[model samples]
Target chain A: MNESDLPSFLLDGEEIPFTPGQTVIQAALTAGHYIPHLCYHPEFVPHGSCKVCTVKANGRPAAACTLPAQAGLAVESDTDELNDLRRTLVQMLFAEGNHFCPSCEKSGNCMLQALGYDLGVMTAGFRHFFPDRPVDASHPDILLDFNRCIFCKLCVRASEEVDGKGVFSLTGRGIMRHLIVSAESGRLADTDIALTDKALEVCPVGVILRKHVGFAVPIGRRRYDERPISAQALDDAPRMMEPKHG
Target chain B: MAEGRIRVATASLAGCFGCHMSLLDIDERLFELLEKIEFDRTPLTDIKHCGPCDIGIIEGGCCNAENVEVLREFRRNCKILVALGACAVTGGLPAQRNHLDLGACLSEVYLTEPGLVNGQIPNDPELPLPLDQVHPLHEVVKVDYFVPGCPPSADAIWKILADLVAGRTPRLGHGQIQYD
Candidate 1:
C-alpha cells in the first residue's frame, strides 16, 4: 500500500495516522496526543487493566490501550462523559488504596496522582476502603509500600519482560486482588531483584520505592510538579525507551 | 443573616489545623476578605457553634463522634459546605488509622509505647469517642465544593473565598488544584 493510503483514525477531531495493528493509545502517543493511561507501557504488551484511558471509539466506550485504531473511527477522549468516567476510575483507585499522597515519597512524581490532577479528580468519590495491606521493607534497597499500589501491572511487565526476572505478579481477584512477589518466601528480598531492575522504575504509583532516597527530590522540583501530566506524557513518552535505572 | 456580608464559619475536627493556617496565609488579603465576609462560628472568633451562615468551611475528616456532630451541625446551619483540604476531602493522614484495629491502635498508643510512665487507655465519659474509621466530610454530609491540597495553598483558599464573596461558585483552576 502507498504511504498516503495508510489507515488513519480521528481522535477528538485530530487525524491520527496508524500503521496496521497499532492501538489507539500507541498512535495517539506517537502523534503527541496523550490518552491518560497507567497499565499500558510501550515496552510491554498492552495491559488494559487500568481503564483510565477509556475512550469512545465510534461512540462505544473502549480502553484506548488495547483498542485498535481503525480508519475513520471517531474517538472521543476529552469529552465530559469520558473525563467523568476516568475520574471515577481514578477515584476508585484512591478509595481502594491507602494513598496518603502527602506522606508518600513519590508524591510529586506519582503518575496516579498526576492523572488525578489531570482529570480534575478533587475527591475520592466513594467511601475509603482502607484495606489492611502490609508494607514489605524486607529488601535492603527497595521498599514496597503496598498501600499505594493501583494495580497497574507496569512493574509486573517490566520485571517479566524487560528485566527478565519474574519478581512480581498480581494475586487474587476483585477487591481482594493484590501484587505478590514471585519468590517462594513471598518477599522481594528473596528474589534476585536489584536496584537497577526495570521493575523499580516502572511503578506509576509510590508502591515500589527505592530505600534511602525518600524525598530526595523536593516537592516543587519533582517531575510532574512543574508541569501537568498531559504535557509530560507527550514529551516524556518517547523517553520510555531509554533505560530508566542503571 | 447579615444583609450585606457573607457569613463564613470554619472548623477543624480530626485535622492538624493546617488548612486554617493556610487560610491565615492570605495575610493582608484577609482584611480585604473581612470587608465582604463576616465570621460566624470559627476558631478565629472562638465561636462555640456554627450559626446560620452562607458558607461553612470544614478542614478535617470525621474521626470522632464530636467531629460528626459538628459536621452535621454545619450542614444544618450553612447554605454551602466546602471540604477545605485533603483531610476533609479524602480523610487524609487521619484516615491512615482506618486500616488498623481501633483497639490495637489505642493499645499501641497507650499500653505498648515505652515513653508512657503511666500507660492506660482513658475510659472517661468526658472524652470524645473516636469512630471505628476516619471518614471524609462527604461521607458524613454533602460537600458542595472541595479545595484539595495537603492544606490548600493560601492563593487557592483566597480564590475560593473571593469567588464566593463575589457571588460566584467556587472553581479551582491551573495551580489552584493540587493533591499534595
Candidate 2:
C-alpha cells in the first residue's frame, strides 16, 4: 500500500503517513524525526542496548530502534523521559567500558563520550566495573582489550559484512555475552585479521584497538567527549545515495 | 644532582615502522630532550653500527638472528634496558604470527608459487634473515622496565624521560601502564 495514499498521523506534529503495524517512533523517523542511536544501525538488526535513541511514543517510553511505524501514533522525542533514558544509557556505557577518556586516542571524539555529555550525564551513580582484560596485542597493527567492550557488535558485523571475513564472533551468555574471535581459540590478534579490520572502524568504544597512531594529534584539537549532536545524528542521517526521485 | 647525563639508544627488529612512528609522536619534545641527554644510536640520528649507551629502548619484537644479536648488544651496553612498546613488552602484534606454523608463514610471505611476489625473497647477504618465530624482548634478555601499549603512549615516553631527567627511577618495571 502506498504510504502517501494512506491516512497520515501527526508524528512530533509532522504529518506522517500512517502504517498499519509500525510504532510511533519509526513512523516519526520516516516523517524525519531524527534520534541519536549507538546500538541501532539501519543496516543490521539492532542490539537496542545503547538507548541513546529512545523516544516517547504516544507518551510511552520506547526504543525507536525496534519500534515499527504505525498510523495515527504520536511521538514525544523531546520529552524528559526520553532524554533521561538517553543520558543514563550513555553514562552506563562509559562506566562499563575501560574508557579512560583523557588518554584514549579516540578521546575528544568518541561517540559514547560525546553522547554522555550531550545528555548531561555528569554525575554517575552506577558502580564502575574495573575488569582486567589481557591486551591482545598479537596482531602487528591491531589490538583488543575485552574489558573495554560495550557489546556493540559493530566489529562482528563489520568483519562479516564488509570485510567478508568472519574474524569476530559474539559469544558467552547475558551480560557475559561479548565479542570474541570466530575461531575456536577466540583470540583476537591471532585470528589472521588485518590492520584495518572493519571491526576497528565499527567500534564505538576503545575495546578493539590499532597500532601506530596515539597521542599524535594535539590534545587541544582532539574530538571532545561531549555533546554528541553531530556524530549521533550523522549515524541515522538519511542515505544520500538512495534515489530521492525513485 | 646531575640527574646523570642519560644516554639512550633506539632500535627495531621484525616489525614495521609503526612503533617508530609512534615514538615520533613525541613531536618536538624528542628534539627538546636532546638538549639534556646524550644520544648514542637511533635510526633517526645515528645509522652506522650502534655503540654502547646507558638506556637502550628496543621498539620491535625479536624474529631473527640479528634481533637476538641486537637484544644482546643492548643488554650488554645499556645499564637499563627498556621495552618501550607492546611489541617490545608483551610481544605486541608481531608475536601473533608466532601461532602460525613456520613453514606456512614463510611460504605465504615468501616462497609460495602463487604469492603476490613475482620472485622469491632475495637471498641477499645484507637482508636480516627472517626467523621462525617472533618473541618479546624480555624472552631474549632481562628488560629493566616495560612500557606497554601498541606503541607506548607519548605521555608514557615523556614520563619515563622526565623520570630519568629528574634522577628518579623510571617506573615501568611492574604492572601494565596503558594510556588508553
Highest DockQ scorer: 1
TM-score of each model, paired residue for residue: 0.95, 0.51
How much is the lDDT of residue A103 in candidate 1? Answer: 87
B-chain TM-score for every candidate? 0.96, 0.83
> lDDT of each prediction vs. the true structure?
0.88, 0.65
In order, the first chain's TM-score in every candidate is: 0.93, 0.80
lDDT of 2 by residue, B66-142 (tens): 99898898899888887776566545456556546767776777777673757566678987887766766766788
**Native contacts kept (model 2):** 0.05
Ten-residue stretch with the least lDDT total in model 2 chain B: B171-180
Tens digit of lDDT per residue, candidate 1, span A132-175?
A: 99999999999999998888888888998889998999999998
True-vs-predicted CA distance for residue B99, candidate 2, Å: 28
lDDT of 2 at B165: 69
| Residues A1-246, model 2: lDDT tens digits | 665687666656777664554444444445565666776655555666666777777777777777766666676676676777777776566545545544456655566755554554432334444344556766777777675677778888888887889898888887677677776666665576887666678787677767787667764454542224444455455433221221
